[model samples]
Target: MMLASSCRRFYADGSLAPWGVLLAILDIWALVNIFGKPWDLSKKLIWAAIVFFFPFGGLILYYLFGRNSS
Candidate 1:
């Protein structure tokens, strides 16, 4: 009974909260855009690493600076 209650609460809390979902969407967008950029393989890899590790901050930085804008 206790285990079932805990599981119910876990789902009730929404496993991926609103911000988590937003961040996931942003990360996916960033990754796709990163690959579409004109940067070389190494730079694209570096940006991918940053986005993978940093998520929110990396997406902001990439859109603000790293993105080629072309």
Candidate 2:
């Protein structure tokens, strides 16, 4: 009961759990890589949108395909 309440409190304020933090870090990494590349503006914007909207899958797609393309 108490543990459940504590967890609810912890998650109530939009705070991230451990996996969420990891996903955020990966998203940041993908964003940085997307910006740092010499791709054109439209391409960067598209990738940024993908990373922003779909954090985990976007990051994976970027790392697997986009990174080597740049």
Cα lDDT computed for each candidate against the true fold: 0.71, 0.72
For model 2, how does the per-residue alpha-carbon lDDT over 8-67 read when each residue is reduced to its tens digit?
323656765666666677788888889999999999999888777777677878888888
Using all chains and alpha carbons, the TM-scores for the candidates as numbered come to 0.73, 0.76
Error of 2 at 47 (Å): 0.9
Error of 2 at 40 (Å): 0.6
Q: What is the lDDT of residue 39 in candidate 2?
A: 92
What is the TM-score of candidate 1? 0.73
Model 1: residues >4 Å from true position, as ranges?
1-14
